[model samples]
Target: MIIKKTKTILATTMTSAMLLPSAVLGKEDGRRVLEEVIVTAQKRAQSLQEIPMSVSAISGDMATDAAIVDTTDLVQYTPNVKFTAANPAYSSTSIRGFGTPPLAQNLEPSVGLVIDGVSYGRSTFTNDAVFDLERLEVLRGPQGTLFGKNTVAGVLNFTTAAPSFDLSGYINVAEESLDGKRYEAALGFPIIDDVLAARISWRKRDKSFGLYNTTRNNEEEQFKDESMRLKLDWFPFEGGEINLLAFKSDFESVGNGMQHSHITPSGFQVYREADPQTEDDEFNNTRATNAPTFTSRFSEAIALKMSVDTGDNWVFRNASLTAIASRAQVDTPYLLDSDFGPVNALSLETDGPDRYKQEQFELRYTADSDVLFGWGDSVDWVIGMFVGESHATVTQFARQNLTGLAQLAPLIAEGRGVPNAGAAEVAALNALIGAVPNGEQDVFAVNYVRVFAESYALFAQADWHLSSSLTTSLGIRLGKETKDGANGSFANTPVPALVAGQENFDNEGSKKEYEVSPKLAVSWSPSDELTVFGNIAKGFKSGGYSG
Candidate 1:
C-alpha cells in the first residue's frame, strides 16, 4: 500500500525582542534589575535595547549549547533568516525573504557577512567553521548605509573573543554513532605582563552520516573539516592598541546523496528503459550512482586592526579612531556527476585550480555621547571610509559518455521512419563523435571565467537624543564599484555534426556603478521593558558578469 500524506509545516523565525535571555532579569531584595546585552550593530558599542532597529545577539555560550557550528546553523536561531547549501561553494543565505539563489556566480550575496570587523567579499566563505567567538549578531533589514554594498537584505556579524590578560584555556570533544567525531580547543595567555596577549583556537570534525549508495556499496555524504584561528593583541601606548588575526580552514566532502524527488511518467519510462539503478524514489535514504565525485576547499586570511583614543584633545571630544586592513583567499576544486544515476552519463570538473582573493582597508572615527556640530552632549556620530578589491577565476569542464546518449539512438531512428537502424550504426556514430559506447570519458565543453572588481565607499551615521525617552538616527553611504570580466566557452568535441550546433566564443566587458543609500530611524523607550522602533533604509547591490 502506498500511503500519501500531506501536511503544512510552518517555520516561524522568532524575533528576539521577547526572547532575550532570562539572565537579563534578576531579583535582588524584591527589586527587579536588568542586565544589559551590549552589541555593535551600528558599528559602535551600545545596549541592545537602545538600538533603533531589529537585532538578535547570541552569545558564544548560547551558541555552543545550541550546537551552532557554522553559518547554516544560525538560521534556526535568528528570525527571518534562511540558509541552504548544496556544497560550501554554493551556500545561500536569506534575510527578510531576500536572498540570491544557490550557484548564482554572477550575483553578490544579498546578506553580508563580517568577522572581526572585516567584511568577507564572497558568500562562499560563509561555510567556514565558527569557534571561539565572543558573540554573533544578526542585524535585520537593509544595512547598506552602514555595511556598504551587498547588504540589501541584512548582515551577520561575528566577533571573536580577545586575548585575556589572565591565562585561560578550554577543550571540548564529542562523538556520534555514525563514525562522527569533533574536537575543539582554545587557549589564551598574556605574552607580556601588561603589553601583549595571544589567543588561539582550533577545531577538527569528521562526519559520515547520510544516505547509503547502493551502486557504490558505501556511505554517502561524508566530509572532514579542520579550522584554526590565532589572535595577538599589543598595547603600544596609553590609549592605542594593535591586533593581529590569522585564520585557516580546510574542508572536503565525498558525496551529496542527491536523488530525484519527482518524475513524470514518460520521463520515468525513458529513465528505466535506459538504465535505472533504483526503483524507490520517495524520500528514501538511498542513492545509486557510479561516478567519482568529491569537493575540497582551503582558505586563509590575515587582518590587522588598530584603534587609538584621542583623549578629549581633538576637535571631537571623547573620540576614537580605528583602522583595519585585511587579506583573504579561498581555493576550491570539485568534480561531480551531472547525471545522478548508475549510468556513466556525464561529469563536471574544474579545468584547473579555482581561486578567489580579496583585499580590504577601512578607517573610521567614533565619538561616544559627544557634541557634534554644537549639538550638545546628546549626539553620537560615526564616519568611515572603505576600499576593497577582489579577483576570481572559475573554470569548468564537462566530460560525457556517449553510451548514455546512444541508448536512445534506436528510438530516434524509429521516429525518423528509418527501419532497422541497428546498434552498429549508433556505435559508429559514437566513434565519429570522438566518443565510445564503452563508458569512455570525452571532453564535451569547457567554460572559463575571470573577474576583477574594485569598490570605494564612504559612510556616516549620527544618533540624536532629543529627550531621555526619544532618539533619532540618520545614516548614509556613497559608493562606487568597477568590475571587469572575461569569459570563454568552447565545444571541444571532434565531430561538429555529432556534437550539435555549438560555437566557440570569447567575451570581455567592463562596467562601473555608483550608489547612494540613506537611512532614517526613530526609537521611543517609555520604560525599561517597553520600546518601539522603526526605520526606513535604502539598499544597493553592484552589477556583475554571468559565468
Candidate 2:
C-alpha cells in the first residue's frame, strides 16, 4: 500500500509540474476553451488561427507567470514534440521527432532559436535564462522558405518587450513546499524622449534543497540549485531598436536522486542508509563534503535593428547582432538504481565545458505594394543579404566508478569517537583521481546562422498575386554548414553499451545531406473572421550521436 501510494504521488507531482504552464479561461459565451494564438512564422505576423501549421505560441502575458521556465517547457503541451531532460544542465529536444540525440555543439539544432532577431546556438546557449520575454513564438512545421538553416525542423523566436514611453514595472514572487522560492522583477523608465527609451529587468531563483529519505548510503544525500538573468533594452529611434541582454547562473545539487533507493520485493519495506547520523546533519555539517554534482553557465547577447520606410511601397531593414555563451561542470553522478541505491556512481570531470559564440549582420528590402514593379496590381518581395561568423568549443569527460558514502560514513563515525572501524568498511574507500576519471576534448567550428558560406549564409524570396482572392509565392536560399565532434561513443560506455545491446535502441544518426527545402501555401478568406489555408513542406533533422 505504501509503495502504491508513493508511485501515485510521484505521478501526480509530475502531472502538475507539466501542466502548470497552462491556464484556465473565464467563462466565454457559455463555453470554456484554450486561448487563440498569433504567430510570425514567415518573419511576418499572422494569426495562428489562420495558419495550417501545428504551432504553439505562448504570448507575453501568458509566459510571465507560468511554470514554463525555458524552451524545454514546450514539450509538455505540444504533441510529438518530445525532449529528454538528460540532465538539469543539458537537454535533448525535438519537433515532429525530427532531431537525433545531440552529440556535439557543431551538430546543428533540429530546432532553432531566434532572440530579438539574433540566432541562438545550441550547447550551453540552451540554458540562457528567461527574462523580459514579451512573447515566445514556436513555429512547429518547416519554415524553410522564410527562416534559413535549421528551420527545416522549426523555430523558437523570442521577442523582448520594448521600453514603454510611460514608466511602469511589476514584480513576481512564489514559494512551494519542500522549501523552494523564486523572485523576478522588471522596471522600465524613460532614459530619453519618445524617440529614445531604455528598460531593464532581473530575475533570480535562490538555492533551495530537497530531502532524500533514508536510502542508498550517501555522504551527501540532498540536492539544491540556483539561476538568474539581467536584461537591458535601448530604443534610440521610433522605428529602430537596440537590445543588450546578459545572463548567468550556477546549479549544484548534491544527490540528484536515484530511481529507487529502497525498493523491496512485493510488500516489504527495507532498511538501507548511508549512516543516518551523517545525513541527518547534512546541512549543519556544511564544510562541504560529498556534493556529488557541480554546474555553472554564462551567456550574453547584443542586437541592433533599424527599419525605415522608403516610400508607400517599400521598407528597408538592417540588423546587427553578437553573442557569447558557455556551460561547464564536474559531476559525481550515479546510474541505474538497483531498487536499493545507485547501482553505479560515476565520477565525471569536465573543464572549459562547452562554448558557442557568433556575430551577425543583415540587410533586407521589402515591399507591400506593386507600385515599385510593373508586373501586377498586388505583389510583395523580400531580398536580403546576411553575414554571420561563429566559433565554439566542446569537451566531454571520462567516467569511473565513484561513491562518497563509505568514505563519509567512517568520518562521521570517527568524529563521534567510534571504538573502531570495520576492516571491510576501511577497504571500501579509495580510487585514482579520487574515484573519478579525467578526460580532455577540443573542437573549433564556424557556422552561419544566415546569408553566406561555411559558418555563414545569404538568401532571397518573392510573392505574387494571381487575383484578388488568390496569391502565389516562391522562395530560394543557399548556404553552407559545418559540424565536427569526437566523444567516448555510447558503444564504448559500459552502461549504454549494455543497454543498447540488450534493449531496443531507436535513436537516429547524423544527416550529412546538404538540405534544400521549399514550401507552397494558399489562403482563401470568405468571411471577415475566417480564412482557410493549406501548405506542404519538406523538413529534415541533422542527425548525430547522443550520450
Candidate 3:
C-alpha cells in the first residue's frame, strides 16, 4: 500500500506541472484563446484583425526568445520578405519581389523604415541593432498613402518600450563556443510619481574569430557592436504629454567577410604557389590577403515628440494634435582589398571622412467625431504634413602598392628588349624599378561625390463607418522632392604620362519631381472573430543621380 501511494503521488505531481502554464494562460473549458494584438499600422491604434492590410507583428518577448537582433533576422518569420547584405553599408530589404539594389547610394529605398514616427531616408540604417522594443510591425504592399515618399514596396515600423511609473528591469546574456558573446539590459523607473518617468536600455556584442586568415595569421569578419537608448516621458499639464528619445549605435569590423569559391587555372597556379593554404573551397574558412580591410559605422539620433488632446473644440470633438522633430547622422569608414589575394596589389580606402546627416519634422491631427455632417454615424480622419532635408559627402582613393609593381618589372623589361636578363639581374632590375616613382602611382584615382535633398509632403486619410458591419477608407498623398548632386573622378597619378589613357569627368545635375499616390480599402466584419478586407494602392519614387 505504501508503494502504491508513492506512485500515485508522483503521477499527480507530474500532471499538475505539465498543466500549470496552460491553466495560467486563460484557458476556457480546455480551449486556449489567443491574445488580441493592438497595432498602429494605419496611423491609429486598432486591433490587428481590424487592419485592412497584410501585416505582421513580432513582440519583444518573442523576438528575444528567437534571438532576433537585426532586421535581417526577421525574414524567417515573415512571408514574401528577403534581406541581402554584403556589408553594413550595402544592405537591401525586399518585400514581394520588389527592392532596389544597395549599390546605388544616392537613390531612395523602395521599402521605408520608421522608428518612433521618424522615417529613415536610407536603407543602410536598417543595419543598426535593435533592442528593448515593444513590438515590430511590417506592412506588405504599397504604403505611400500615409508613409510619404520612397515606400514603393512596404514599410517597417519599430516601437520601443515607453517609460512606466513602476520600477522594472531585465538582464539577458548569451554565449557561444566560437568566442561570441552578447549582453543586453534594460531598466525603467518613475522619476517623480506619475508625472515623469524614464527608461534606458543597452546591448553589446563581440566575436573574436568567425573566419581564419591564413596569410596574415589572423581572423576575418571579427566585429564588435554596441547600442544605447534613453527615453523620458513628461506630463506637464492636463491633456498634454511630451516624449524625448536619444539613441546611439556603433559597429566595427576588422576584415571583410569574403572568400573565393572558384579558381581559374592561372589563378590556382599563382595563388597556390605563393601560399600553399590558398584553396577555392569557401567552406574551409581560409583566406590569403596582404592588405588589411576594415569597416565601421557610428550613428546617433535624438527626437522630441509632443501631443495635445483637445476636448470639445469648436470645429472638432475628441481631437488630438501631434508634432515630432528629429535629427540623425551616420559615418561609415571602410577599406577594401581590391585584388583579394596574397600579393600586395591594389587597395581602396576612404580618402577622407564620409558623413550623412538628415533632419525631419512632422505635424499631424486626428479627430473622431460621433457625427460627420450626416455622412455617417461616426467617422475618423487624419491629416499630416512632413518636411525633411538630407546631405551626404563621400570620397575614396584607389592605391597601387610598390610590391605589386615589382612583380611586373620583369615582364615589362622583356617587352622593352631586355629578354636575356638572368634571375639575379631580374631581381636587381625589379628592386630598382619598384624604388622609382615611375613604376606605379601611389594614388591611382580619387572619386568624390556630394548630394543634397529636400522634400515636402501633405497627406490625409479618412475612415467612414457606413454601417455596424461595413467600413471604407480612402487615403491620398501629394509630395514634391528636389535633389542636387555633383560627382567627379580625377586622376592623381604622380606621373600623368604613365596614366595617359585614364578617364576623368566632372558632372553636376539637379532634379525636381512631384508625386500623387492614393489608396482605397474596404472591410466587412460579420462577427468579432472574422474580418474580410481588400485594398488597392499606388506608389511612386523620385529620380536621383548615382554612380
Candidate 4:
C-alpha cells in the first residue's frame, strides 16, 4: 500500500503555506538533498513529495530585489506570517492567529489572494504594489472544496514573467546609504517569429527615514514608488494557447504616527519619579515632536488567458481579470497635549481621514486528466468558476478649540446639544462620541456583489498501488454559497423603533450562512532522492455582518 499525508492550516498567505508546497531540509556531507516542489495543490500536477501539503514559493527577484522593497520582504520568507506597519498607510496581516482587522472594510481577510492569476479582493494590494514574480504560491488549508469560499486561511498565488521563446530580461540597480534608491528593468524578445511573444517591465524606488530627529533633518519622510508590467504569448497552433497580463503602480509617502504609550504621571519612571506635577507629563522625552504626514496610492491590473491542448491526455482552461484601486490620506498629529507644552503640547489634529476606491472582476476554469479511474496511473481532477464586485467610500473631519471657554457654562444653559458642547465655540468636538459631524455620511458603501448561483464542485484523487515502496493518495470536496446580502439594502435605522416593547427589537431581515470543505492526503516515495508526507484539511469562509 502506497500512502502520503500532510496537514496545513495557518490562517493564510505564505503563512505556513497557502497555494502550498514547502519542503527543504538540508545536510550536505551527511548526504540528503530534497527538492520536488511542484504543486497546483490538487488542481492537478503533483510532486510536493506527491502531495501532503504546506507550500511556500518565493521570488519576484526575492520580492523586488535591492534589499527587498515590498511585502515587508515577505515576512521573513513565510513562517507564521505577521505584519503591523500601521503606517505608510496602514498594514495588517496574520496567520495562525487567524486575523481580520486590518483597516477593516467590514473585516474580511482570513487570507486568499492571487495576483497574476487574479484574486485579491484586498490585502491592500498585498502590502501595496511591488512584485515582479515568477513564483509566490502559498497554500495552507481549508480551500472550500477547491477554492469556493474565501479560503478560510490559505492562498496567495502570483506567477509572473512568462514570455520568452528565446530572449532574456534583466536590469537592476541599488543604493541605500540611508537614502534608499532602486531601479529595475526587463525585456523579452520575439514579436511574431513563432506565432507571437512579448514581455516588458520596469520599477522604481526611493525611501528615507529618521524619526526622533536630532536634525536628521528630513525627519521621518520620503518613499516613492513606480511600476509597470506587460506580457503576452500566443502559440496559435500547437494544441492552442494564449496568455496576457498587465500591471501598474504608484505609491508615495512621508511618514509619522508610529508611537506607542507614555503619558506619564502614574508612578512614572525614567529612573525614579512620582507626582509633584510629574514634570507636566513628559511623553518619555525623545526630543518631542509635531506635524508632518502624508500618504497616497494608486494601482492597476489586467489579465486574460485561454487554454486548449487536445493532443491526447486532456486539458482546457479559461481566465479573465481586472482591477483598479485607489487610496488617500492626510495626517497631522502631535500627542500627549496635557493642555500645552511643559511636557505634552502641539496639537494639530487630523485623524483617520479617509478616501478609498476599488474595482474587480474574475472568471476561472481548469481541467486535466479526465478521470474515469482504474485506480492506477495516478488519477487527477479539478474544476472552477468564480465572479466578483466591490466599491468603497469613506470620509472624516474634526475641529475644536475656543480654549474650552470656561467649560461652556452649564453646557450653555442646557440649551444646546451638550456633551463637548457646541453651536459655535469651535463647534461639536465629540458630537456625543460619534465624533464631530461635518455631514457626508456614506461610509462602508458596498453597493453590490451578486453572483446568486453558479457553484459546482467535484474532485477526486487516487493512486492505490501502495507497494513497490508506498504511494497512497486521497481527496474530497463539496460546495455551495450562492451569495446573499441585504441590511434593508444598506441602512437600518431605529433609535426608538419598536415602542415600549423592547426585547432586542426583533424583525430580522438579513443573516444566513452555510459551507463545507474537506481534504486529506498521504505519500511516501522512498527513492529517486526520497520522500515522506502528511496532510489534513478543511477551509471555508463566508458569513455576513456589517452595519
Where does candidate 1 stray beyond 4 Å?
A: 1-25, 30-34, 210-221, 259-287, 368-377, 408-441, 494-501
TM-score, every prediction:
0.86, 0.65, 0.86, 0.30
For residues 176-278, write the lDDT of model 3, one tens digit per residue.
5568899999999999997999999999989876678888888776889999999999999999999999899988888877788777654665566557787
Please give the TM-score that candidate 2 achieves against the real structure.
0.65
Better of 2 and 3 by TM-score: 3
lDDT of 1 by residue, 61-90 (tens): 777787767777866888788888878767
Clashes of each: 0, 13, 0, 33
Error of 3 at 333 (Å): 1.1
Candidate 4 residue-wise lDDT at 481: 39
Instruction: Compose the digit string of candidate 2's lDDT tens values, residues 1-547.
Output: 0000000000000111111123346577898654545456556555555444555656667666566555566445556676555554455557766653554334556677676566655534554435666766666666655566665567777666657768978888877554556666777777675655556666665544444433333444343444444444555555444555544445555444332322233112111133222222334422112224444444455555555545553242232222222222222122212122222233343434455556666666665654235554565666666555555444444343324333333443454666564334445433222433453111111111111113334555555665654455556655555443323323223332221232222232222225454656555545544545556665434333333
Q: Lowest-scoring 10 consecutive residues by lDDT in candidate 1?
A: 1-10
- Tell me the tens digit of each residue's lDDT in model 4 across 1-547: 1011122343312212222334455577898755456555545455554555566666565565536666767767887767555543455566555656764543346677666555555566664335456666676655555554566667666666778878898887888765778887878889888888898888888877543422223455466778787888887886566777766676766554243244443212321221122232324322223234456556666666666643333232222122222222222122122222222112322234333333333333333342234443333334444444343332221122222322332334344545543444323322322432334221211121211222334443344444544555454555443333322122122211221121221122332344445555555556654445565666656554332
- In the order shown, the candidates' Cα RMSDs to the true structure are 7.0, 11.7, 12.6, 21.4
List per-prediction Cα lDDT, in the order shown: 0.78, 0.47, 0.76, 0.48
